[model samples]
Target: MSGSSSTAANLVRTVKVKAEKKVYSLPGQKYAVPEEREPLRIFYESLSKQKPESEMAEFWLMEHGMMSPERAKKAYEKKQKRQKHQRMGTPIKAEISKETSESSRKSSNAKNDQRTKKRSLEYEDSDDDDLIMKPSKAKQK
Candidate 1:
C-alpha cells in the first residue's frame, strides 16, 4: 500500500528524520553510526566522574575550553543565571514543602479548636448539674 501512495504527513515525517540525521552527523567525518550508543548512560557516566554540582562546570570546560578561564567563568555564570531564572518563575520542591507545612498547620489549628469547643461543652454540662444540685440541696436543708 505504501509503494504507490504515501500521505503528506508521512512524507514530512520522513524528511524531518533525514534532516535530523544529517544535522547530528559530524562534518567531514566518515564513520558508520554506532549500532548501540546509549547517550544518556554515557552522559551519566561522564557526570559520575565528578560531583553532581560540578558536572555542569566540567561539561562547560570540556565543550568550550579549560584554558579559557574567563570564558569558563562567564559560561558558568550564564548557566547559573539561567538556572536561577528558571527556578524563580516556577513551582519547586520548596513550594511543595511550604504548602504542605501550611496545610498541616491549618489542620492542626482546626483540630485544636474542635478540642477546645468539646471541652467547653463538657464544662457547661458539669456546671449546669452543679447549679441544679446546689438548688436541690438548699431546699432540702
Candidate 2:
C-alpha cells in the first residue's frame, strides 16, 4: 500500500514536469542521449578521404569520456608510424621465419661439412709413416 502511494506521488511529479516540457524527456536528463561514435576505423576511413585528423580526434575525444588530448596525440603518432610501415612494406611473420630457418640450415650444413673434412684429414694424418702407437699388453708380454 505504501509502495503504491509512493509510486503515485512519483507519477504525479513526472506528469507535472512533462506539462512544462513540450516533448518527453529522459528520467534524469533533459533530452534523449546521443548514440556512441564509431570506432577508429571510421576515423581512418575519413582520413583517407581528406578529413582532418585532429578534428576527427576531437570528435572521438568528445565521445570517449576517459580519453584525453594527450592520448589522442599519441594515437595520431602511432597512426603515422603505421602509415610509414605501409609505405615501406612489412614482411610477413612466415616469410621472416622461413628466411631465418634457411640461413640457419645453411650455416649448420657448412659447420657439419667442415667437421667431416677435419675428421677425414685427421684419419689421413693417422696413416702417415711417422705415426707411432703404444704396444698392446699382449705384445709387451
Candidate 3:
C-alpha cells in the first residue's frame, strides 16, 4: 500500500510538471522560436489596443490603423447618412401603388373566406361527444 501511494504521488508530480511545460503551436509549426513568435505577439497586442467603440470608429481605425482626420470625416458622414435614413418617418401612402394595395386586400379577403369555409365544414362533420375526451382505462389502473 505504501509503495503504491508513493508511485501514484510520483506519477501525479510528473503529470503536473508536464502539464505546466506544455506548449501550443500551429499545425505546421511544431514550436515557435522567439523570432517567429515576436511578430504574432506584436500583432495581437496592436489588435487588443485598437478595439473601436462604434462602426464609424471601426472604419477609421481600419483605414488608418489609428483615426486620421480625413478618414474620421468620411466615417462621420457615413454615420450621419445612416442616421438620417433611420430618422425619416414611414414612407408616404402615395409611394405604394393602387394596384398593389388592391391586390393585397383581395388576397387577404380570399384567405379569410377560405378559413371560414374550412371551419364550418369541420364543425358540421364533428359531433359533441367526439369533441369531449375521456380518460384511458389503462391510465386509470
The estimated TM-scores of all candidates read 0.24, 0.24, 0.30
lDDT of 3 by residue, 1-141 (tens): 689988888786433344454343222122333343466545543564685334633443433333445554666566566667668953323245889899999999999999999999998888876668887678563
User: What shift in Å separates residue 85 of candidate 2 from its native position after superposition?
Assistant: 33
lDDT of each: 0.54, 0.55, 0.56
What is residue 49's positional error in candidate 1, in angstroms?
29
Per-residue lDDT tens digits of candidate 2, residues 42-93? 5544553574445454334333432344654565465556558778897323
Q: Residue-wise lDDT of candidate 1 within 47-78, one digit each (tens)?
A: 64665445453444334333245544555565
Task: Give the top-scoring candidate (lDDT).
Answer: 3
TM for candidate 2 is: 0.24
User: Which residue pairs does candidate 1 place in steric collision?
Assistant: none
User: Candidate 1 lDDT (Cα, whole model)?
Assistant: 0.54
Per TM-score, the best of the predicted structures is 3
Candidate no. 1 TM-score: 0.24
